[model samples]
Target: MSTHETSAREEVDAIIAGAGGWRAEALATIRAVIISADPEIVEEIKWRKPSKPEGVATWTCRGNVCMADVLKKAVRLTFPRGARLDDPTGLFNARLDGSTVRAIDVFEGAQVDEGALRRLVLEAVAENRAG
Candidate 1:
């Protein structure tokens, strides 16, 4: 892998490690789901700051597909172009009021629909490639 890709993955790993407990596990699972959805998806770390130096874990396919954040009680997966995508599975539980972005907040002990998530990732990638 390239140095940049290696660094990005490392950063994401550190973020997941820092999260600890179920949040960490959820983030790891989310990462796998995103990657498994598309082979060409690239991992990235963005929006670094003093409080969140590790940044956010982002996946891209031709363009930005989705991003994951470890919240206090949940792991949030946000799609930038979610409004345009068809979410028949109703996986999105947050940001429904927004016109652009949509998010899914996975709380502790909550069951995640891997199949639905994978389809969402595929749709996001397709959206990115279409533009």
Candidate 2:
């Protein structure tokens, strides 16, 4: 990995480590699946603030593929170009009405279909590239 990538990874690691409990576990698991789906994917943290110390985790290729934020009730994974992607598995359960974005909100105790999520990520990447 490049130096910039390493720095970003370290920053994201600190964010994940600090988000203890289920949030931490969920972020780690979701991150692993995203990386597995695209080996060259770039990870970064955005929108940092005192209220939200961890900011949000964003993965991109050419442009944003998806971002995940740990909320009180669920982990929201949003795809900026999701409206254009074909979601056959119906994994997206949030932001359905948006004209450009769509999201999948994973609540606590909910089992994530990693296969479907990965497919969505791949499709999102394709959408990004096509733009």
Candidate 3:
């Protein structure tokens, strides 16, 4: 991995570590899936602020693949170009009305379809590359 990507991954790790309870667990699980889906995928932290220093976790390849945001009630994983991808499994449960972005909201105790999630990550990567 490149130096920037390495730094970004480390930042993301810190973000995950800083989270508590279900948020941290969900973020870690999603991070694993994103990384496992593509060896070359880059992880980054974005949208930092004073109140939320950790910001959001962004996974990318040729372009933005997805970003995982830890919310109060759920962990939302959003794809910037989700409208163009085929989500037959219906993993994307939120942001469906948007023109481009789509998201999957994982609440506490929710069981993520690992295989399907991985496939979605792969598909998102392909879409990014094509664009």
Candidate 4:
């Protein structure tokens, strides 16, 4: 590998090593979203995985449970206010046809639209903070 490629690989390895789990990338993504949206968001571990307080749905931004799901090749990011995003890219749940409710999911082998995810996270943080 070229020096640059080697350096990048080393950096990723270091990050993964320090990240502390098999779900490190997902954890990092979620944490980046939360921190960008609200630095004050309280993070705690529940059921041995990271959980955050989403407000209103069963796993609302203010609710006690913010869901985290990981699969053999990908991770899921489910938000409590998933139904409220100003924009939708068919990236959410199949069952949610309502205007203001659903789940944001990141699946394997498909590129997640980061902009959409950011908007969802931004809105979720706002919803939770408003509570």
Candidate 5:
């Protein structure tokens, strides 16, 4: 799929629909992180990801992948294979009790480590290839 083929709203409707208002905001966060890092991947909101590719794309394997969910106070960033990434930044330890796929919660005015999250996503993509 290409940008001329569809619009962002149409793409958002694909996965962000029925996700509620906060869902769009959560999607925005996930997107901001992904683009801020690797701004060159052929990103699209197919199923699991609304602003990026799911499973395999320009990189990675057919793994569980990452996702975000809206919460009462914040959005939870869940990486299904986070344990595989050797994160230099401690952006994923809060929601995770030392697990593979970890969650990073972000809320209003909360200082989110965008670079770190982006690194985590890229790392997950790289890990997919490693295995």
Candidate 6:
């Protein structure tokens, strides 16, 4: 892996570890699912600042696929091109009103539809590659 990619992966690992409890587990699970969806997907740490220096956990193929943030009440997976992707299983539950993005909010004890999420990731990668 490239140096930046390695650093980003390490940053994500730190974020997940720092999250602790169910949030950590959820973020790890989400990361695994996203990676499994496409081997070309790249992990990134974006939007770093003093308030939240760890930044957001972002995944990209040819373009931005999604970003994960550990919220107080939920772990959010926001798809940048979600508006163009089909959601037959209706996995998206937040940011529905956005014109170009959609998000899935995973709260404590909530179950993620892995199959649907994998499909979405694949679709998002394809979308990125197409452009």
Compared with the true structure, what per-residue lDDT tens digits does model 3 show for residues 71-128?
A: 8899999999988889898899999999999999999999888899999999988887
Number of clashing pairs per prediction, in order? 0, 0, 0, 11, 1, 0
TM, every model? 0.97, 0.91, 0.92, 0.53, 0.62, 0.97
Tens-place lDDT digits, model 2, residues 29-81: 88889988987689987888998876778999988899988788888889988
Report the candidate with higher lDDT, 2 versus 3. 3
Candidate 6 has which clashing residue pairs, if any? none
List model 6 lDDT by residue over 1-119, tens digit each: 99999999999999999999999999999999999998899999999999998999999988899999999999999999999999999999999999999999999998888999999
lDDT of each: 0.93, 0.86, 0.88, 0.50, 0.58, 0.95
Ranking by lDDT: 6, 1, 3, 2, 5, 4
The list of candidate 2 runs beyond 4 A from truth reads none
**What local lDDT does model 4 show for residue 81?**
60
Q: Which pairs clash inside model 1?
A: none
Error in Å for residue 126 of model 4: 1.8
lDDT per residue as tens, model 1, 1-131:
89999999998999899999999999999999998898899999999899888888999999899999989889999999999989998999999999999999999998889999999999999999989
Among residues 3 or more apart in sequence or in different chains, the pairs in candidate 5 whose N, CA or C atoms overlap within 3 Å are: 83-100
- Candidate 4: tens digits of C-alpha lDDT, residues 70-125: 54444555564656555555667532766545655555445556676666666676
User: Model 4, stretches more than 4 Å misplaced?
Assistant: 1-27, 47-65, 94-101
Whichever of 2 and 6 has more lDDT, that candidate is 6
Q: Counting only residues 3 or more apart in sequence or on different chains, how many pairs clash (N, Cα, C under 3 Å) in candidate 5?
A: 1
Task: Look at candidate 2 and tell me the lDDT of residue 105.
Answer: 89
Candidate 2 C-alpha error for residue 127, in Å = 0.9
Misplaced by over 4 Å in model 3 are none
Candidate 2 C-alpha error for residue 73, in Å: 1.2
